[model samples]
Target chain A: MDFLELDAVTKEYPNRSGPPARVMDQVSLSVRQGEFMAVLGPSGCGKSTLLQMAAGLLPVSDGTVRIAGRRIIAPPPEAVYVFQQYTRSLLPWRNVRDNVGFAIEHRLGRRRAREVAEAQLDQVGLEGFGDHFPWQLSGGMQQRVAIARALAAEPAMLLMDEPFSAVDALTRLDLQALILEIWARRRLTVLLVTHDVDEAITLADRIAVLTRRPARMAEMVEVGLPRPRDAVATREAPQFLALRRRLLDRLLLRHDG
Target chain B: MTAERLLRPLPGLCVLALILGGLEAAVDAGLIRRALLPPPSAIAPVLWDMLASGAVLPPLLATLRLVFAGFFIGSAIGVAAGLAMGWFPPVFRLLEPVVELLRPIPKAALVPALMLFLGIGETMKITSVALAVLFPVLVNTLQGVRGVDRVMLDAARTHGWGRAHTLLHLVLPAALPFILAGMRISLGLALVLAVLAEMLAGQGGLGFLILDMQRSFLVRQMYAWLVILAVLGLALNALFLLVERRALHWQPALRP
Candidate 1:
């Protein structure tokens, strides 16, 4: 069995004054144990809605989501989400360590959770930021702290929703590298939803292209790239450029149609 | 130093000093009659007399006690009810109309009705202040809880936080700023109702002291009590601001 699975998942949002809109239509996918899959689509394409359904944040109108052969009714502690707005994600009342430690303490006991949170902070290269509040940190640093919070839970699956879209391009590159390093080290099954094609190409093991509103899986392209990939090397490679061209062609063609 | 830090409070202090100095000068020069506007010198001596004899201390203590008790009780009920109403659509729809109906009725006007049931005692006085203070805190709390970002909520749920856990961990922390703002407004209202209750019930408080002095034609003493009330109000406001700053220090500074 696959590490994670989504079977014919459909989500429809009710409209009071109009016909109920179907956001996701018979969406289905699967993730292997160490696979990093990126779902790429235009805005309002229900890529986020798909991610939410997988995380069990939203109920599937008609389908099933399973993790390790077990059907998911709701979000379990083993699967965690990293949100896009890192600044608002962390509670303003809590310091960095406590925000990370909150889930740990709730899941584990106090003493054990604190140790795990500290270790996760270290893993994210945010060891000294434990005492600082979210507002005191820079945008990139805040996102790292949020990543640390999710990592502390030691979840098997990590779901990211446009996690670096709010940061500057330079910071986004740095964070992407950081995430890649972490994913390599932890071997986490990751499903990232992003509008940035370059980001999807750079990070994902396989890219799932999605259609616009009432979204369906359009295509899936495997990225056969070596580990510890450099940005310059990957972009310059003939195969990488070919894949990028192909994805862009698919996207622009969809737009024109 | 920041420009705002230096300039923000300057005009307010200047206006307050100018008003007090002008009032004192007018009274001293007989431009305003002594009975109508007692000079600072006269009022100072009367205030000193009351403080030295400890004539005002007991009632002042009693009034403080009542204010705090009412504030705690009313705030506890308001926060709990507001959270429930804000979280559940059915509960909100049911309670909103009743809350709106009762909110506008003058709190001071309810004093006579309360006195008939509880009599002119501590309960009546505290109840009056509590009723007056409850609405702002309740409304603000409800709004605050409702105003939490839907994105943040989804993030929490996706992280496997249950409904009850989300309320305590996410909703409460996010809603705290608005709740504190409401509490600050309620604190001032609490003080107002406490004084008003004393004045109307003919009981002993700073309000009663002012009334008694006026009846006896002790105009200077009445002015002195008024000064004390103003100071008390200022002190309470300052305390609320201090708490607010400490609690919300983690929020990033935003340009207005």
Candidate 2:
């Protein structure tokens, strides 16, 4: 059995007039344990909605989502969603350390939670900046704090909804590398949703191509690139360019069509 | 410090001194009647005498007690109700109509009924002030809770936080700016209502002292009480600002 499964899941919002608006249609996908999967689609393709459903933040209007063979009705404990808008997602009142530790607030006492948060901050290269509030940090650093916060939950699966889309290009590259490294080290099952084909090619084991609106999985492209990837070397590689070209063509073709 | 910093308050201070000096000269020249508008100097001396004789403390303390007690009670009820109404649709649907009906009716108009039930005592005065404070706080808190960013709530939900935990940690802190803003407005209203209640009830408060002195034709003493009230208002406002600065230090706009 797959670690995470979305079997013909669909999402529809009720409208006051006319037919209900559909966001996802029969979107079926299965993620294996420790697999890094990226769902690539056009803008407003309901990719975020799809991730929300998988994270159990939104109810499935039809079908079912299962994690570890258990049906997910509400937010599942073993999964955490990293939002695209890191600045708004983090609690403004909490310092970087406190926000990171917020996940374990109920499970661990204050002291233990702070200790865990500090350790996570250290891992994310924010070691001495624990006392600084979210607004005090740069956009990239704030996103890093958000990542650390998600990790603090010690989730079995990390659901990232266009997580790096808000940063600068240089910062985006750095975060992409950092996330890949973390995934490798932790052996985490990650479902990253994005419109950036290059990003999908860079990090994912398999790229799940999605249709424009009322999204459905169109194709699954296997990324044959070797692990322990380097930013400069990986992009320069023939396999990387080939995979990037294929994914981009698929995304653009579907978008234009 | 910069030259600009040094001269920041100069214009206001100069204008105040000029006004006081002008008023004193006008009164001495008999252009303005002393009985109608006592000069600042005469009012100052009377204020000093009242403080020294310990005559002001009882009324001042009474007013303070009413304001604070009403402020706290009103704030507690307002925040609790606002949180409930904001988070739960059922609660909002049930209470919204009743709240709207009561909100527009001036609190002073209810004083007669309140006095009839509770008597012209501490409870009546405090309840009047509490009613005055309640509306602004409750309305602001509800707006604040409703105004909380959707993505933040999504973040909380995705983290597996239950409704109670989410509201306690996420909603409350996010709504703090609104709550504090309401508190400041309510603080001023509380003081106003407390005095109004005291005056109407003929109770032992600064308002009563002012009325009592005026009836006896103690013009300077009445003027002195007015000064004390102005100072009290200024002091309360200053204290509230201090608390606001400390509490919302994390807010980017409020950062020093």
Candidate 3:
């Protein structure tokens, strides 16, 4: 059995006046342990909704989602979501340490939780910044705090929804590298949703392209690139360029069609 | 440190002081009869005497006790009910019509009927104040709970926070500012109703003291009690603002 499985999953949202609309049309996918998968699609492609459903934030309208053979009927603490908006993700009222500590404290005892949270903060290169509030930190630093919070939970899976889209170009590259390092060190199974093709190309071991609204998987591409990849070298590789061109052509053709 | 900040409140305070001084001068000069509008100086001595004799302490305490009791009880009920209504649409639909029916009827107007059932005592006064305090708190709390961001709710749910945990941790914390604001308004209304109930249906409190002085033709005494009442109201409002400031220190303060 796959570590995480979505078997013929469908999701529908009801409107008060109109007919119920299907957002996911019998979609299915499987994620193995320690796999880094990125889902790339255009805006309003219901990719985020799919992530929400997989994380158990929304119930499947039909079919089933299973994590390690257990069906996901409601949110399970085993998997955590890293939201797109870093500013709104962390509770403003809580300082960085407390925000990270909150998840640990809820999951474990207070003293052990604080220890774990402090350690996770250090791991994220935010050791002394724990006492500072989210607003006091720069956008990149805030997203780091959010990442630390997710890591503190020791979740089996990390569901990211364009977590770097809100930051500057310089910061986005830095964060992408940071995520790669963390994923390698922790051996975390990551499922990231992004619109940036470069981001998908740089980080993902496998990329799943999603179609427009009422999203369905269009294509799945495997990155044959080796581990510990350099950003500059990977972008310069002939294989990388060829893959990017092919994906762009596919996206444009779909758009025109 | 800021020049604009230093200048902002100066003109308003100066104008208020000037108007008050002018009113005192006009009354002292007999442009307005002392019987109708006694000068501040005349009322000051009467207030000193009342305070010295401890004549005002008991009633002030009575009013304070009633206001606090009513405020806590009303706020508790309102917040719980509001959360229920906000989280569950069926509960909102079931309770909304009844609340709307009771809300518009002036809570003060029920004083007579309450007095008839509960008598012209502390019970009637507390009930009146509680009733008056309930609506603003209920409405504000409901609005606050409803206004919580959908994304936050989703975040909480995705984190495996159950319904009770979400209410205690996410919903209550997110809605705190609105709940506090509503309670502040309700506190003022609670005081108003307490005084009104005492004046119309009872024989004690600042309101009754004023009525007593008026009956005895002690206009200065009446004015003195009125000043004390104003001071008390101002002090209570300041206390509430202070508590609100402490509780919501995370929020940036707005300049007026």
Which numbered prediction scores highest in TM-score against the true structure?
A: 2
Instruction: Please provide, for model 2 over B134-245, each residue's C-alpha lDDT reduced to its tens digit, 9 standing for 90 to 100.
Output: 9889999999999999999988887777799889988998999999999999999999888888888966888888888888999999889888888899999999999988
Model 2, A140-225: lDDT tens per residue?
99999999999999998999999999989999999999999999999899999998888888899898999988898899899979
Model 2 pairs whose backbones collide: none
Best by lDDT: 2
User: Which segments of model 3 are wrong by more than 4 Å?
Assistant: A15-19, A109-111, A231-233, B2-8, B28-30, B51-55, B88-90, B252-256
Compute DockQ for each candidate against the true complex: 0.58, 0.81, 0.55
When candidate 2 is compared with the true two-chain complex, its DockQ is 0.81
lDDT of 1 by residue, A121-210 (tens): 898888878888777889999999889988887889899999999999999889999998889899898999998888888899999999
Candidate 1: stretches off by over 4 Å? A16-18, A109-111, B1-18, B24-31, B254-256
lDDT of each: 0.85, 0.91, 0.85
Per-prediction TM-score, chain B alone: 0.91, 0.96, 0.92
Per-prediction tally of clashes: 0, 0, 0
Using lDDT as the measure, what is the rank order of every candidate, best first?
2, 1, 3
Query: Model 3 clash pairs?
Result: none
Reference contact recovery of candidate 2: 0.81
Give the Å shift of residue B253 in candidate 3: 4.4
Residue-level lDDT tens digits of model 3 in A3-71: 778788888899788988988787788888898889988878888888888898888999899887899
